[model samples]
Target: MYIVNEGPNNAPTRGTLKRRDIDDNTGGTPIIGIPNLHIDEGELMQGGQWITYILHSDGISQLRLVRIDGQEQQTLYCAPANTHIANMQLSYNGQNVVFNQYPNDGGKPSLYLLSLASGSLQLLLHPQNDLAYTPTTWLDNTHILLTSFIPNSGAPRNDLYALDIIQGSNQHDTDLQKLFSQNWSCGSFDVSYDTTKLYVANCDASNGLSATGPTTISVQPSMGGTPQPIAHLNQAVTMLRAVSPTMLLLMVENGSGDTSQNGLWRMNTDGTGLTRLTDDTTGGQSLCPYSQYAWSNVTQDSKLFALQETDPHSADRKLYYGSLDMGTLTPFADIADGTDMRLVGWTLY
Candidate 1:
C-alpha cells in the first residue's frame, strides 16, 4: 500500500510499514511481520510488480527500486549531499519516474526523470529558485499537471499546467500556459477520468495541508479557470482521490481522539451522496484514526478497503479493513504505535 500520514507535524516515514494480506474471504488472519529498512516515500508502480521509493532516514538521501514482494531490491539513485529528493511519481507504465530535487543551497526544486529499464536519468525542467513546480498527477501516459502558488494574483492565485515530457525536449518551461487558478491553496487535487475536469481539495487559509482548519471540495475546467465549490467540510482534509469521474475518496481530520468525526469519507463530485465509510459504530467504541493510505490504487471493486486506526492518544494501532460484499469495517493487523507506515501501494494477489 502506498501511503502518507495525515497526522499533523509528522513527516513521511517507512518505520510504520506493517503488511496485511488481502482477505480471501477465508477464515484466516491478515497480519504479516514488519520489514527492517525505513521507507520515507514510495509508490507501487502501475504494473503492480515494482515499488519505486525514496529513502532519506540515513545521512544519504536515495531513490530505490524493488519488486513488491521483496525481490530484486536495489538503489536506483542517491542524492548528493545538501540535496534531497522532494516528490517522486512513477509513470503509469512503470518504466519511468519523475521527481523534484531540493537543494540546500536554496534553489527551486529541479524536476527530473529516470528511465528504469535503461537507467537513464536526466534533468527535465528547472524553474527559478523562487518558484516551486510540484507534480500532482499524470494527465495521461505522457502529460503531467503541476501546481504552483501565485500570491496576490488577483482572484484565484494558484496556477496549474501540463508538462509534456516527450515533446517538451531539452528546453525548460517558465512560459507554459496556465490551466486555471483557485482562490485558496489546493492541498490535494486530481483529474477526472475523461481528463476534462479537475477535482480540488482546498484547505483553509492558515492550515494548508496541516488539517487545522476547514477544507472545501470543488471542481473546475481541466485547462484551468475559476473553481466552483461542490462540498465544504468543517475540518481539514488529508487525502483526496478521484475514484470515479463523479466520485471522490477523502480523509478528514475531525480531531485527536474524536472517533465519531475522523476517518475515511466518500462522496460524489457534486458533493451529494456524502457517506462516512469508517466510523466508531463498527469498533464498538471511539477509535482514533491517526493516519490513512492516500494513493487510490485499491478501491471497493477490489473487494476490501483498509484504514489504519488506533485508540486515542496512545501508541495502540491496528490495521482495519472493510469488506465491500459485507459492508463492514474490521480490525486486521496489529502495528507499532506512533510509527508512520503509510500505504506505498499494495499487491492484491
Candidate 2:
C-alpha cells in the first residue's frame, strides 16, 4: 500500500510519499523525497499502474502523473499562478481525471476534466449566481456524483446531483440530474459498491459548515426514491463508506466523552447490528488510538482498510490496518516523524 505524509506543521506544508507492505506489517520505505511537493491531493489510478498528484511550489500548483515505481514522472496540467488543485478523482478506467480548481486568495471554484493520454483539459462546470457544484466521486467512467449548494447561505440543505459526461459535448452538453425526489440534507454519504443504494447521514449543519447535531442514517435508491430511516446517532458522523451491499463502516466525532465511541464503527446496511471497531483510548492500551479515517482509503476488496493513528513508540501518526470482520488492528508503518499522514489508495504492490 502507498501513503502520503503531510507536513502540516512545517513552514510550508509539503508531502512525502511512501510504500508499505501490508502482509509484512513493517515500516514504510520512502518513494519520493523531493522538496516542496504536496501529495495530499492525489490518488492511484485504477489497475495501480500510475498515480495522479498535485505539486505546489512558490504559490503555483501543477498536476502531474508518475508511474507506480516512482519513475517517468510528467506534468499533465499547470494551473494559473496562485491557484490550487483539489478534489481530484481519476476515472474508473484510469484514462481521465476530473478535479476542481480554486484561487488561493478567494473566489468560487470551477470543475475541469483532463485527458491523461493527450493532456487535454476541458472546463466542465462553473458556479452561476448562488448555485455551485463540486465533484464528489465517480460512479463510473462516464458518470460522476457532485454536490450542489449555495455557498455561505446557511440553508442547511445541500443536494446531490449526477453529471453525465458521455451524453453530450461542451459545457451545454453536460447533463445534470438531481439524485433525490425532495430537498434532502446530507452530511456523510456513500453509494453501494454495485451502485444500487445510497446511504446518507443526516447531520445537523445549522452553522453552515460543520456538523453540530445528531445524525440520522438512511438508505434509498441511488437514482431517487423515498429514504428509509435506519440508525440514529447522537454524535455527528464525519466519514462513512459502504463495505458491501449489506455492510457499512463509519467514523463519528468524539464529542460525547466516550473513549470507546471515538474512532471507528461498523454496522449493517439495514441498521441491524452496530459494533465499535476502535477507540480513542491512548497509552498503547486501546485497539486504535487517535485514529483518522478517509473515504477512499480502503483496499480494492473492501475487506481491509488503512487508517492513521498515533504510534505509541514515536507519538507520530502511523498507518494501521483493520479488517471488516474484526476490531483489532495490525501496526504497519509510521508515515513521517511528527507529521500527519493520509492513505492515498491501495495498489497491486
Candidate 3:
C-alpha cells in the first residue's frame, strides 16, 4: 500500500509519497514528493508504473501524468480558472481517461476524456436539462458507466447511464444509453468482476440528499434487467464494493450514537453470511470514526485494505492496513506525526 504524507501548513497537499508492505510491521519507504498534489484524486495505472491525476492550486487545475518514481512528469491538460476537476478514472486498457469538471457557476458538470497515447483531449459529455453527470466506473475499454442527477437541489433525481466512448469521441456529442431510471437515489454501486452483474445500494431520497432510513442492496444484470433486493440494512451505507463475484465490502454509517457498529464489514453477494470484520467497540486497535478507506485493488479477489482517520480537534491523521477477516489493526508507522497523511490507492504490482 502507498500513503501520502501531506506537507505542513504552507503546502498541505504537497508532500512525500511512500509505499508500505502490510505484511511487514515496519514503516514505509519514500517514493516521491510533489507539490500541489491531490493524491486521492488520482488513479494508479494498470502496470503500477504511472499515475494520472489532477493538480489544483491557485484556482486552476492541471491534468498530469507522472511516472511512479517522480520522473518524466507530463502536464496533459490545464483547465481554465473556475473549473474544478474530480472523479477521475483511467480506462481498463490504460489508454484513455475520463473525469468530471464542474464550472464556477455551480451549474451542471461536464465530463471530459483524454487520450494518453495521442494526448488528445475531447469534450465527452455535457449535462442536458439541468442534470449533472458523473463518471462512476469503466465497464470496459470503450464503455463508461455514469450517474446523472441535479446538483444541490433537495433529493436530486438519480439515474444510471452508459457512454460509448468509441462512438462519442467527437466534441460535445456522446452516444449514451440509459440503464436504470427508478428515481431511487443510488448511494453506491459496482459491477461484478466479470462485468456481468451490477450491485447497487439504493437509498430513500424523499427526505434529503442522504439516506433517511434503511438502504437496500440490489443485484441486477449489468446491461439491463429487473433488480433483485438481496439485503436491507438499517444503517446508511456510505460505500459498497464488490470484492469478489460472491463477496462484498461495505462501510456503513454509525448513527446509533456509539462506536459499537463503527467499522468495515463483509457479506456474500447472495446476501448471506453478513459479518462485521472490524468491531471498534470490542476489538483491538480500533479504527473508529474513520473518514475514508480504499481496497488494495479493484480486483474481485482483493481483500486487503487501508483506511484513514483524522482527529477532528487537532486535525492530525493516521493510517491503518489490514486484510479481510482480521478484526485487529496495526497502526502504520513513519507517517509524519503532525502532517496530514492520506491513504492513496494501492499499486497493482
Candidate 4:
C-alpha cells in the first residue's frame, strides 16, 4: 500500500508485511517520506488485479494505477488545473475507471471515465444544478451507483443516483435514474456483489444534523423499491460498511453525549445480533475513524483490517488484523507519524 509523506524527516510513511510469510512482521526498516506526494483515495479493482490511488502533486490531482504486487506504477489521468476529483470507481473488467471532477470556481461536478490501455479520458456525465460526490459500488461495467449532493448544504443531505455509461445526443438522457430518496442526511453507501441489495445509514430523526438516539439502517433494492428498516440503532451511526451479504461493520455513538466515546460494532445485515468491538469509552478520544476497514474472505478464512489508535491524539495509529470468529486482534504495522492512512483492501492476485 502507498501512503503520503508527513513525518518528522519528510520520509515516506509506508511499510509492507506478509503475515503468512514472515515471523517477525515488525522488523522492516522504516522509510521516511516521499516528497511532493499526496494520496487521497485508494481502491482495488477487477478482483484485485490492480490498485488505483488518487495523488495530488504540483497543485494538481492525478489518478495513479499500480499493480497489486506494488510494481508498475503508472499515471492514468490528470485533472485540469484548479479542479478536484471526488469519488472514483473501477469497472469489474479493470478496463475503465470513472470519477467526479469539481471545478475550483464552483459549479456541478462532472463524471469522467479513463481508459487504462489507451490513456484516454472522456466525460461521462455532466449534470446541471446537481453535483456527484461519493462513488458507490459498480452495478455493472457501464453503470455505477453514486450520491448527488446540493452545493452549499452544510449537512450531508444527498440522494442516490445511477449513471449509465452510454451517452445520448441529449445530455439529459445520459443521467440514468434515482434509486432512493431519503428525507434525512445520508452518506457512505455500498451495494452487494450481485448488485441486488444496497445498505445505507442515515440519521433521519435528527433535523439536518447527526445526533445520538436516532439512526436508521435501511436495506433497499437497487431498482427503486420500498426501503425496509432493518435496524433502528439507539445511538447515531457515524459510518456503515458492508462486509458481506450477511454482515456489516458500524461505528456508532451513544446519543447521550459526544460520539468519540463510541466505539466499533458489528451486526447482521438485517440488523440482528449487534456486537460492540471496542471497549474504549473515554470522551474526546481520537480513534482514527477516517481510515477505511475491510473484511477479507480468502480460502474460506474471514479476517478484518483496520487502523487502530494507541494514542489519544492519533499520533501513533497502526494497522491491525482481527479474526472475525474469535474477535482476537493482532497489530499489523505502525503507519508512520503525520500521515493519515486509509486502508482500502488487500489485493490478492
Give per-model TM-scores: 0.74, 0.82, 0.82, 0.79
TM-score of 1: 0.74
Give the Cα error of residue 122 in candidate 4, in Å: 1.7
- Candidate 3 lDDT tens digits, 150-228: 7877555568888888776443423578888745453577788778888888765434544443678999999889999
Q: lDDT: which is higher, 1 or 4?
A: 1
All predictions: root-mean-square deviation over Cα?
Answer: 6.1, 4.7, 4.3, 4.5
lDDT of 1 at 221: 82
Residue 128 local lDDT, model 1: 54
Please give the clash total of every predicted structure, in order.
13, 0, 0, 6
Q: Give the poorly placed runs of model 3, Cα more than 4 Å off.
A: 1-13, 36-40, 152-157, 170-175, 182-186, 209-213, 256-259, 280-303, 311-314, 333-339
lDDT tens digits, residues 140-242, model 1? 6777777664323323335677888886544366545567654434346777777778887876544333234467788888776778999888765656777
The Cα local distance difference test for each model comes to 0.60, 0.67, 0.66, 0.59
**Angstrom error at residue 89, model 2:** 1.2
lDDT of each residue in 90-204, candidate 2, tens digit only: 7767788888788886566778899887887888866555666667777667887887656556554367888887753345323578886323343577777677778888775
Which runs in model 4 stand beyond 4 Å of their true positions? Answer: 2-4, 7-33, 130-133, 168-174, 183-188, 204-210, 254-261, 280-300, 308-314, 335-337
Question: Where is model 4 poorest over a 10-residue stretch in terms of lDDT?
Answer: 14-23
Question: What local lDDT score does residue 246 receive in model 1, on the 0 to 100 scale?
Answer: 64
